[model samples]
Target: MSTPHTRRSFIGHAAAGFSTLALPRWGQAQPATEPAPRPAQIEHAVTAPVAIEVNARPIPAFEPRDRSRTRFGSLQYRSGLVLTSPHRGFGGLSGIRVDAKGERFLALSDQGSWFTGSIRYSGRAMVGLDDVEAAPMLNAEGRPITEKRLWYDTESLARDGNLVYVGLERVNQIMRFDFSKGGTRARGEVLPTPPAVRKLPYNKGLEALVFVPKGQPLAGTLIAFSERGLDANENLIAFLIGGPSPGQFSVRRTEKFDISDAVLLASGELLILERKFSWFTGIDIRIRSIPLKSIAPGALVDGPVLFNADLGHEVDNMEGIDAHVTAEGETVLTMISDDNFSLLQRTLLLQFTLVE
Candidate 1:
């Protein structure tokens, strides 16, 4: 019934409005400093996964490929819907934010480190040009552009308010922008890796941010988490830290929590997704839970609720996680996979109901 738009078709319209899709006028150099290495090799320590016996349910297995809608970097869920799309500059899709009206807004983070523009979803998952574009300096092209690399392994959006946060993995900083009034402006900032955190071995960089509910034991404190370790192959549980501000973070070497795609729950608990790779190829996706208060630098992580997928079933790079309350007042957890645009990857969006 519908035909997919090709690169030619996508760019043809841009060529008409030549002034729109312009490159960033200026390019900023990344911070020039080598990250400090961890003191010693982290012993391959697997903390006992804490049991998260939720009402277990499974979603269809996702097979990612290196096509259009395959490379997923980060994602979010607003009003119980998942937003999955491309992240940076390729005329592709950026991230998505579901609004209060149950409408999905396409967000572009071409601000380099600042905030950019947004697009509104029209039918199904596709959006119209009029959806976004009037915003200030949103994209590098000065027009509506997708496929942007805001940061590596990170992207963010907020619901119930005009708050937006983006993680700059390279510099390990989180830029906070307020949409409450309008126009994206940096209201505050936080550096994920403090001087001490930079000392961790293979601290490639920090890249995940999940806000803990205020009033909870861990409320008001932002959790600056990361997907750091030896190599991309070897498995490493992400680390979590409580920070009231960027430079000032709660650092305790002893408390380490392991969870894949670290996400915080509505109840102030942290949901950990474990990606089990098959001996040969495929990956098994599982879910585990932990209380926000249980996260300390030295606190050992034990017990994890296992969300089911096929064992050894591989997809693309699975990153980004967000939880929302469904219209029925039920809690739902959704996930998206990063295609990486690699011949070996595909964009996958998986959803599940949390049974605890």
Candidate 2:
């Protein structure tokens, strides 16, 4: 297990490698002109889905300094890729949902665009992506959702069968889309939330979402977590919407980390992917495992750290995570990074197997 102090020490050791790097401030807004015009502009021009070519380069090792090492905490590194595309609206991926077979995937950008594709795999290792397409998220009026005021910072995503939920951080709102209607072309409607959800601080609200499906502890519930929303006790505030116990709860805050993305396992464990940034340390990412049965309204939940990585490992602004079970019963976790469309950053896809 990694305590705050131990993690800090690890970061300090990794600082030397990142000293010359100028990393983008994760989650902060930048000028549209700075990043070759905002992605929304490019997406807006795309009224319908457009096929895009995404190029992927393999990451042969998780830690370049230790190529032979495969285990990090409770996870075993499988493979990784550096993803790039010629499409201007391709980066800034903040959320993703992978299918049960770990092939088909649906991802979204903070600029209010949708990306759908399938992963090409060699046995259990990811080799590349194929048949990718990009489209703008449409409103009920069939216009781009970015057309709405303060609606482009779409940060979180959750899926239940054919239904998809998107959380916009700038305005602290969630939108519901029925994929059965039109897939990524589906028009979205606002999903009403608790009053406090709308009151979270701008830029720090609605960062991660997890939809608990049938047979789970919080089945039929959409769990929404703020990036840094704090309660009276200073714990991270989260909401349980449209469930048997629909209300608020807190996740015990530790190590100054904020929630980035989350996934609910079939075995009833909620795996939260979190990250923290500092001028001295660059970026650090980790995963925590919380028992789903322990979550309830007004409850303060905590979990054990299952994995941890720093700039020492292959990582960027990691923001999305999903898990699938192999036919052999192995649980595999996939993670994606939000590049923020900055030339200084990169979009990375990584995978690991849960060893615990």
Candidate 3:
């Protein structure tokens, strides 16, 4: 084993207008944002697809806590695997989403690549990935986002019907893609997020996005959260956009955990994926649930920790999450990690049965 490196995360630059979103380095006032009438249409062209491929290897053991395969909290480990590709643009996958059937998956990298693939199963356990394809996240001009700008660090994703919303962390902006027409080839139009969102610290802003389904309590509401965006009082901030209610709320920060990703359950409960890093502990990840009915303006939302794991287990910088239902009516939670395109880190895909 390699010696665990001891280091703390450093602050990054803010968005276009703000000096800082949470922690002020220069101390400046934040500008307010005027909400647009709705999502503006993006005029994007179809670009030639980039050639990409992936290789998957099997990991036989599902349980990482121990040899017993005992359940931990409400989640049971299903399987996990590391993914690699010869394509140089691969890795840094910070956001992910899956179809209702759990078969198809889409993940976006901070490096501006889109990874699409399907899950392959052997019996009931996940065995590998299939039909994997990687493409650049195109800009409004139909060129790769990285080719367009340096700040296009795609980090979080939320989907409702044919509309998909992707969060760019370093730039502190949200881009909406209308897939009802061209699918992944759809042009991306910027969404009018709150001025506070624009103030979030670069590389930590807008880490999680979840859209409540029509039947949910907060139906049609779009929820966006920061990785560690703190208020003057040091409360973690979250925004409720669109829907019947639109406002800001707080989520209590504990154990140095920051939001990595989140998914909404059929029961209207929000499952948040949080992570922590330390020289002593290396890395730690957890899942916490907050009731949708509890999230309101200025509400301090907190919930029981459903699951937790550390570096002793098979984990890296796990950052993306999505949920799907099985034919047996079971809910399966899927997660992915951002390798940071580093040899020291790995791109991992893990799954577990959510037995709430």
Candidate of highest lDDT? 2
Question: Compared with the true structure, what per-residue lDDT tens digits does model 1 show for residues 1-356?
Answer: 11222222223323322333333222223345955433332111111111111121222222222223321222222211222323232221223333323233324332332223332333323222222231222232232112244333233333324656655444455555555633442233443444644543432444455655566665555565444532233333244444443332222111122233556665767765544443333344555666766665544444445454432233233555565565676565545554333222333444445554
lDDT score, candidate 2, position 351: 94
Per-model TM-score on C-alpha atoms: 0.53, 0.88, 0.85
- Best-to-worst order by TM-score is 2, 3, 1
The candidate scoring highest on TM-score is 2
Off by over 4 Å in 3: 1-46, 62-65
Candidate 2, residues 1-356, lDDT tens digits: the string is 44343354345435433443221111234466786646666444545688889999999998877899999999999999999997878888999899998899999998898999999999888999999988888888777887777778889999999999999999999999999998888999999999999999888999999999999998899999999999998999999999899999999999999999999999999999999988766788999999999999999999999999987788888999999998999999999988777655678899999998
Overall local distance difference test of candidate 3: 0.76
Spell out the clash pairs found in candidate 2. Answer: none
How many pairs in model 3 have backbone atoms within 3 A of each other, for residues 3 or more apart or on separate chains, i.e. clashes?
A: 1
Sort the candidates on lDDT, descending order. Answer: 2, 3, 1
Residue 314, model 2: Cα distance from true site in angstroms: 0.2
- Which 10 residues in a row give candidate 1 its minimum summed lDDT? 42-51
Candidate 3 residue 346 C-alpha distance from true site, Å:
0.9
RMSD of each: 15.6, 7.1, 10.0
Writing each residue's lDDT as its tens digit, candidate 3 over 1-356 gives 42241121111101112331111011112335734232222122124334466766654444433556747689887877778888766777888898888888888887666778888887767777777766666678766666555446788999998888998888888888887767777778888877888989876789999998888887888899999999776768899988888899999898789999999998878999999876555677899999999998889999999999766566678899999999999999999987766655677888889986
Task: Assess candidate 2 and give its lDDT.
Answer: 0.87
